[model samples]
Target: MDFHALQQRLRRFANERDWQPYQTPKNLAMAMTVEAAELLEIFQWLTPEQSLNLSDDQRRHLGEELSDVLLYLVQIADHGGVDLDAAVERKLAMNAIKHPPKKS
Candidate 1:
């Protein structure tokens, strides 16, 4: 996805609604944690097998919570002037080196 465009869109969304004042990094972080908690709650009682086999209703709810966390993450990164693409690439490179493939 075009994250830059998405960030601008999110910014405009909040701006038009006058939600910018409430979209501070702190608040966004807190809100993301709450959404993450909600996400965790969805699986709190389910066994591994059950969690893997969600019903349609559970799947929809899972997607909503995931999006909530992602949206806040986008906003937070935008506000922090972080380039998500570059950051992800850098982290992935580091991870690849740290966890190199083992020989068969």
Candidate 2:
């Protein structure tokens, strides 16, 4: 998928909701954390097998919560004027520098 296009689509979604006012960078950051916590709640007390066996309905709910988190994260990154792709590339470059190929 084209991440930039996806970002623009998310922006349009927020615009349709008139939610941009509440979606300041700081607020989006907080909302992302809150939604992430909600996603985690789904797995709070289940055994590994039970969690893994989540029904379609349960999975759909979890997917909604995860989407909420991702929406907020993407908005926050956009609001902060951060180029997420570039940031990820820079981090990977730093990791490469730190963890070079081992000698034979």
Candidate 3:
């Protein structure tokens, strides 16, 4: 996935709507959190097994919620001047050091 392109698309989207002012990192983060809560709501009442076996409609809805979370996250990262690819790499490296794989 070309995140730079996606970021640019999002920028164009907001710019066209004159929404860049409201797209500050703090606001976007808050919106992302709200979307995250909506994503969580999808499985709020389901058993673990049931959550894994969503119906087609449920899966579609889940995707929409996930997309919302991701777009807001991208916007937030862009406003903060963070490269998500590098950030993910750094975080994964930290996780590897924090929790090495067990020898089987």
Candidate 4:
């Protein structure tokens, strides 16, 4: 799946509904953070084993919440006129430089 294309489609969907006005860069960023916090709530204080045992219903709910977070993050980047893929790549490049491979 082309994430860029998907993001574009989602943007168009929102535009058609006149939702872009509410999705200013700052507001979208805040929404992303809120959704992330909601996603985190599911795992708070839960051991790996306990979390893994979550029922299908719980898993589905978590997945939806996680997707919401990602969508808002994409929207935030889009609203800010940033290419998320390139931004992430640039950050990863910096991280790679910061944590270079160890010599044998």
User: In TM-score terms, which candidate is top?
Assistant: 3
Residue pair clashes in candidate 2: none
TM-score of each: 0.94, 0.76, 0.96, 0.82
Residue 43 displacement in candidate 2 (angstroms): 0.5
Candidate 1 residue 79 Cα shift, in angstroms, is: 0.3
> Number of the top candidate by lDDT?
1
Taking every candidate in turn, the Cα RMSD to the unseen true structure, in Å, is 1.1, 3.0, 0.8, 2.1
- Across 38-94, the per-residue lDDT of candidate 1 in tens digits comes to 999999999999999999999999999999999999999999889999999999999
Tens digit per residue, CA lDDT, model 2, 1-104: 55678789988988999987897888888889999999999999989899999999999999999888877777787889988888889999999999997985
User: Rank by TM-score, descending?
Assistant: 3, 1, 4, 2
Model 3, 104: alpha-carbon shift in Å? 4.5
Worst 10 residues of 2 by lDDT: 1-10
Comparing candidate 1 with candidate 2, which one achieves the higher TM-score?
Answer: 1
**Reference-based lDDT, residue 38, model 3:** 100
Order of candidate numbers by lDDT, starting with the best: 1, 3, 2, 4
- Cα error of candidate 2 at position 20, Å: 2.6
Higher-scoring candidate on lDDT, 1 or 4: 1
Q: Write the per-residue lDDT of candidate 4 for residues 1-104, one digit (tens) a residue.
A: 46678779888999899987897888888888899899899999889998989989889989999899888877777778888888989999999999998984
